[model samples]
Target: MEGFLYQASIYLAAAVIAVPIAARLGLGSVLGYLMAGILIGPAFGLVGQETADLQHFAEFGVVMMLFLIGLELEPRALWDMRHRLLGLGGMQVALTTLVIMGGVMAMGHQWSVGLAIGLIFALSSTAIVLQTLSEKGLMQTKGGRSAFSVLLTQDIAVIPMLALLPLLAMPGGLSSRVNEATDHSDPGLINTAAAHGDTGMSLVDGLPGWGVTLVTLAAVGAIILTGIYLTRPVFRYIHVARLREMYTALALLIVCGISFVMYLVGLSPALGAFLAGVVLANSEFRHELESDIEPFKGLLLGLFFITVGAGINFGLLFGQPFLILGLALAVIVMKGAVLYVLGLVFQLRGRNLWLFTLSLAQAGEFGFVLISFSRQQNVVPGDMTEILLLIVAMSMMITPLLFILYDFLSRRIKDADEALEPDDVDEQARIIIVGIGRFGQIINRFVRSSGYETVVLDHNLAAIQRMRQFGVKGFFGDPTRPEMLHAAGLKDARVLVAALDDPDAAVRLVTFARRERPDLHIIARARDRTQVFRLYQAGANDIVREMFDSSLRAGRYVVENMGLTEFEASELQRTFYQHDRHSVRELAALWDPDMPTVENQEYIARARELEAELETMLLSQLEDSSDSDSDRKSA
Candidate 1:
């Protein structure tokens, strides 16, 4: 227990120290975790053999993560990705395997060895890729989604790869070491099951292929059925206990039980968990489940990444530095080439194409399982297995750098190719709207519907094209560019709307426009009170807080539900809005751009005073209305 506490302390301490620094430096948390692992395990020797075992346990994080991801995706959404999953994902595995295999064969290895190596390298790290994509907020992009489809396909392909591995086992190829280690553990996460010793359970053991298939099918069926029919009642039962901990326990029970079943049946536990999540995607309790599982998933995933760094066979790597480094780079380059072409073939362009290519270039965590399994199956030589392990770890370690590079390239890509010039504005309108995002779109429609000519300009080519489909004429260009603004007729425009999604960009545009055309009536969209002050300071005639109006409507709705008439509620809302707007203009004068709001005593005192005044005025109005109503009734 003492030893365990020490180990935990070391890991937690390392994370606390490293992660924030990495985040500050823009290196991402994953890389920080990896670096921490390397420090504690390899460089400092604070951790040792337990690293491999810990990694296996940490891999549960991946299962939990898949469950969460599945919760986000309905069956219909998963079905919609069928084409990319089959076409893009399937081809990537096949082509990458064949290419890597051929390369291995060229290096004087036998066909079986080459094929084993190929299968191992074909897969990318789903945990790392998905986590990184999510962190960077790129998971919803065309490239990120495509990458996810391929990762999902690779996971499914692991089953077939495992089945085919033993078939390639050479006659008398088993080394004594391998013979001693053959325990038929599940794929990935090292020899976790074997390390823990046999549980004496036999669901798929010694079964014929058909029998195993039936068992697999039945297990999957049970998960789906449980999700659809059983989870609700189970949750409701747990809810009766009125313990927040019970919900967490139940969520864990669902994941762990499904994982154990999958392990017993020789299937991917992560895949089973994912399947269960998809089944429950539309459940009323989905959000509750997500909230319960999210913390565990995050911690475990972080531990898993740390273990990966700790488990690196640095001795082997240093012994053959060039050979290992060369192999790792080769895998990344070969896979990158395949993904790039696939991206092009599938119509991925600009930043997205580069994103898709760079993100999946590294060998994944699953490679560890395949490499170890191959050794037990005698498909890969012992010496080659160590090299492959090093290569996989090194590649996984390099993934974050690839993501950083993608960030760099994405900035340069700017949504369109450099060769694609901006659309020329042949005509000008009285009203010019910059950035045709949600905010500007409504204004454009309203102005146009009222028989007013308006010019729309946006940086997103896709958004512009989509708007054009709705018969809204929007030119594709960076609205912040001085030349673009001039072409859009900012000089003669009566009203200039800076409704950009980016607060900084909107402020900059407003500042530039105001300076260029002082007479131009510039209305700017602000994300928050801070932005409102910034935009007001930038000389925007009217600064619209994005959520203020919606929030007021919601507040009015609440008041209406609380026994107030709609008219009275609306009057209250109107009074609040007017007071709020006037207070904003007053506070903008006191807002110090150089100082934090909490530190500004004048601003705080004035804000408090305004709040008190508004409350008193609202109470006075309500009292007057009540008195008038009473008088009329008495009359």
Candidate 2:
């Protein structure tokens, strides 16, 4: 127990210290975990051999992650990706394998050895790629969706890969000897069906090939049936317990139970979890399942990456640094070439092309599993197993850097290859709306309904084009650009409305417009109080907080439900609004852009005083209303 506590503390401490710093530097959490592992394992030796065992346990995170992903996708959506799944995904694995196999054969390796190596390197890191894409908010993009389809296809392909490996086994039958010499616990750190060992339990034990197949099919069928027919009642029963923790426990139980079933049947637990998730996608309790499983998924995935980093054999890596590094690079380049061609063939251009290419160029966590399995099957030589392990780890470690490169390229490209040319400004009006998003659309509709002519401009060409389809004329151009503003009649416009979603862009437009047209009245949208102050400083005549009016209405409803009459609620709400506006104007003068709001003493004191004043005023109004009601009853 003491040892477990110490190990937990060390792992937790390393994560805490390293992850935030990495995030601050924009290196991402995966890289941070890897760095933390390297520090604790190789550099400091604070953690030792147990990292291998912990790796197997930590791999459960991948299962949970797939479950969560499945929850988000309905069967229909999965079907829609069938083309990419079969075409792009199939070609990637096949071409990458053939290419690598040829490379290995050229190096004088046996055909069996080359084929084994090829299969190992064909797959890419799913956990890292998905996590990174999510973090960067690129998951909804064309490239991201394409990558996901390929990943899903690859995951499904793992079953056949597992079946094929044992067939390629050498005559030596070195399974036991290799298991002893190599760390089956580590296996170069990947989530694969190969990791589902025959220990602790087995439903398919000693079964014939046909029996195993039937049991696997039955297990999957049970999962689908359970998700459709059993989950609702099970959740309702758990709901009767009324404890929040019960819901969480049930969620964990569903995941763990499914995983155990998959393991017993000699199938991938992650695949089973994903299947269960998809089955429950339309369930009423879907969100609850996601909320309960998300944190565990993140933590476990982090632990898995840390294990990957810790399991690196630095001794061997340093011994053949050039050869190992060269092999890793070769795998990346070869995979990239295949992806690039596939991307082009599939009509993926510019950012989407690069994103698909660079993101999946690294060898996946499953490479570790395949290599270890190959060693056990005597397909790969013992001396080469260490090299393969190092190669897989190195490639996974470098995956994040590839994503960083994608991000850099994305920034430099900025959709120039695909962006339509800015629409010509052919007309000018007295009033101009700088953005035509949700906030500006309402204003445009109102003004047009009132028979006032106004020019609309926006940076998003798609949005502008969409508006045109609805008979709302809008020009596609950056609102902050001086030429776009002038073309929109900023000089002659009486009122300029800045409703851009980007706060910085709105500020820039307001500042430039105020300078160009001193007499113009500018109304700018502010995301929050800080943005309100920013817009005020930029010389916007009126700054409207985006949610301020809606929030006031919601508060009024709350007070009305709290025993106050409708009239009384209205009076209180009006008083609050007036007081809030006055307080904001006063506070705006004290707000220093250079200092943190919490650290500004004068601002803090004034804010407290304003809060007290508002409370006292509200109480006085309530008392007056009560007295008036009493007098009316007496009369």
Candidate 3:
């Protein structure tokens, strides 16, 4: 127990120390976790030996992460992405698998071994790519969405891979040796069945292959049904108890139960969790479940990456440095080449195509699972397993560096493009709107209704067409392009309103407009506090958060519902809005995207203190008004 505690302390300390430093360096938290694992495990020899044990425990994080991802994806959204999922995602996997299989076979491996290895290597890390894209605010970009679609397909593809792996086991191969290699006392249901024989302890046990398949399908169907029918009632009962802890526990219980059922039927537990999440996607409890599980998922995923870093066999790497490094590089180059071609074929160009290529050029976390499972089935040699694991780890480690390179290259390209001549300003308008989406449309309506000459520009052809049908003239072009901004009459426009959906693009436009036309007043729409800070840095004259006004109105309604007069609620809301706007500017000045986590936390604490001070001042003013009212009544 003492040793266990000591190990825990070391792992915790490594994460606590490394993650913040990584974030501060702008390399991101995933890299920090990997670095932490490397530093503690390989470099200092502090936690290297314990990595194997920790790996199994950390894999649950992957399972939980899948569940949260599922919660975010509704069935309708999945349907909408079917083309990209099948075309971009499916083709990438099939092509990559065949190419990798041929390569492995060229090295004198058997067909089965080649196929298994190829399939495993085809997958890219969902955790790393998604987290990186989201953190850098690229998720909404064309490349980011394409990457997401492909990753989702890969996740679903894991189901068949799990089933296919067992069949790929070589006849008369080292099955016994493989079992011995993977032997663990608590190896879970599937491993237990494989080792000790099917005991028929569960209903599906002792079933024929076809029977087991049917049972597996039935189990998945049952999960979907339960999610659709039973979850809401169960959650309602839990919510009635009003115990947040209980709600969290129940959320975990549901995920665990679904995962266990899938495991018993010899399926991917992550797939089962994902299916359950999709079923509950539209449920009111979806957000609640996500909130409850996110922290656990994040911590476990961090541990998982750390273990991946720690588990790297440096001795093997040093012994065959060229072979291992060559293999990893080969895999990345091949996958990246395939993704880039696919991106071009799909009409992606410039920054988007590069992002798609670089984002998914590495072996994913699932590669570890497949390699381990293949070794257990004697499909791959034990020595090969270690080599493959190292390769996967090395590939994952380089993913962040690829993204950093992409950023650097993209900025240089952007800088070069800045010299391009602006488009001819044919029709000068007093007001210019960058985005004619929902927010910009409303603003355009009000501005034009008041008799102002407004020129609107939008990149979305469909949006432009729709606006034209409604008698709104919106030019179709990229608002971030200097030429497009000039064509939209930025020079002559007194006020420029940027209401673009892409926060990064909005920031870029703001920065460019500020630099080019400093006299023009820029009103930018921010999605949240982070965007607010970014836009302020970009020199927006006024930043209006997308939901701030609606939220204030909601607060006023709440105050009125609590028996306050409508006028009083309105006045209170006005005061709060004014104070909040002031606070936003003051607080934004302290916010730095590249700041260390510790400093960011300290800033948050200080902001909370300021909020308390504001509340106290407001209360004192209310008390003084009450006292004055009472004295006037007595007089």
Candidate 4:
């Protein structure tokens, strides 16, 4: 117990120390965890050499992550992403495998060995890619979505890959020795269970091949049915318990129970968790389950990455530094080139293409499983397996650096693109609209109809093209670019509207415009209260939340529906709007983006008090008006 505590302390301390520093240095938390693992594992030897054990445990993080992802994607949403999942993802796996297999065969490897290696190399690190994309706020972007689809396909493909491995095994090639080697080396859950003499517990243990397959299918069906019918009621009962800790325990229990069931049936536990999540996607408890499991997922995921880092055979790397380094680079280049070409064929242009290519160029954690399995099956030689493992590890290590490079290159390209365009401020307009998307379009129409000259700009090429088809002209350039702003004649513009769909970009544009043209009146669109606060900080003269006006209009209709006259509803709405606007400014003043949770709670409480006070005052005024009218009629 003491030794266990010591080990835990070391791992926790390393994460606590390393992650913040990495984040502060602009490196992502995933990279931070990996670096921490490297530092503690091989660099200083703060942790013991039992990385495999830690890895086996930490892989639950990946399972949990997949569950969260499944929860976010409803059946309809999954169906919507089918084209990209099938076309982009399917092509990527097929082409990448073919390319790698061809290369391996040319190097005098057996066909079976080459095929195994190709399939293994085809998959990219889902954990790393998704975590990085989420951290950088790119998961909603075109490239990010494409990458996600591909990752999902690869994960699904693992089932078939597992089934295919036995067929590729060479017959009569020291099968006993292979089994012995596998017992010592295979890190997979099934193999680990077998190593621990838990075969009797496996659902497929005594079954024939067909029976085993049937049972596996049955297990999956059971999970789906339970998710659809039984999960909600179970969670609803747990909710009535009113113990958050119990709810959390129940969430973990569901995930673990499903995982164990999948393990028994010889399937990927992560895949099982994902299916279960899909089942509960529309349930009221989905968000609660996600919130409950998120911390565990994050911590475990960090531990998983750290283990990946620590498990790297640095001794082997140092012994054949150039060979290993060359192999790693070759894999990245080959995968990236294939992805880039695929992106182009799929109509991904400019930044999105590069993002898709760079993000998915690394070998995945599953490569470890495949390599170990291949060695055990005699499909790949022991020496070759070791090399492949090292290469995969190196590739994983390089992924974060690749993201950094992408960011740097993207910024430079954006700047160069802006610089290349000559700033010809020929057509000057009084109102300069930074974004001509849905929000800006309405604003532009209002200004144009009011007889004000307006110039519209948008960064999306496709959007600009579509707008031109509708006879609405919009310049294609990033509004955050100072050069683009100047090209739009910011100097002589009387008013500037920051109406970009991206809140961060909108904030950036507002900050730049406010600094450059202090005399110019700025109208900024915010998506939420957080953005409202940010826009206010950016010197937006008028900040309009995108949904606020529409909600108010809805409220007015509700008042009319509740037996109030249209005029009375309108008047009440006007009063409420004024009060709400005042409240927003006051709240914004109290809101520090980095404020403590306790202080934030206090602020929220104060705001509620103010709202109640305003409601009472409004009712009092209305009563006074009614009483005055009654008195006048009597006179």
- Candidates 2 and 4: which is better by lDDT? 2
lDDT value for candidate 4? 0.85
Measured on C-alpha atoms, candidate 1 has an lDDT of: 0.88
Model 4 alpha-carbon drift over 4 Å, by segment: 171-175, 182-200, 205-210, 416-434, 446-462, 469-471, 475-635
Minimum summed lDDT over a 10-residue window in model 4 is located at 188-197
Indicate whether candidate 2 or candidate 4 has the larger TM-score. Answer: 2
| Ranking of all predicted structures according to TM-score, beginning with the best and ending with the worst | 1, 2, 4, 3
lDDT of 3 by residue, 340-432 (tens): 999999998878889999999999888877877777777887668778988999999999999998999889767655444433446669888
Looking at candidate 1, the ten consecutive residues that score lowest on lDDT are 180-189
- TM-scores of the models, in the given order? 0.94, 0.92, 0.77, 0.79
Task: Give the clashing pairs for model 2.
Answer: 190-365
Overlapping backbone residue pairs in candidate 3 total 1
lDDT for 427 in candidate 3 is 64
> Global lDDT of each model?
0.88, 0.88, 0.84, 0.85
> Could you give me the TM-score of model 1 versus the true structure?
0.94
lDDT of 2 by residue, 1-635 (tens): 99999999999999999999999999999999999999999889898878877888888898998899999999999888889999999999999989999999999988888988999899988899999999999889999999988887787777788789888877875756455445545434332333755555788888999999999999999999999999999999989889999999999999999999988887778889988999999999999999999999999999989988888889888988999999999999999999999999999988999999999999887777787677767778877888998998999999889988988998877867336577779889999998888899999999999999999999887788899999989998777889878888887899999999999999998999999999999999999999999999999998899899999999999999999999999999999999999998999999999999999999999999999999999999999999999999999
Root-mean-square deviation of every model: 2.7, 2.9, 6.6, 6.0
Error of 3 at 204 (Å): 4.7
Q: Quantify how close model 4 is to the true structure by its C-alpha RMSD in Å.
A: 6.0
Candidate closer to the true structure by lDDT (higher is better), 1 or 3: 1
Report the lDDT tens digits of candidate 1 across residue range 143-256.
Answer: 999999999999899888988998999788566636534533321236724422233685888999899999989989999999999999999898899999999999999999
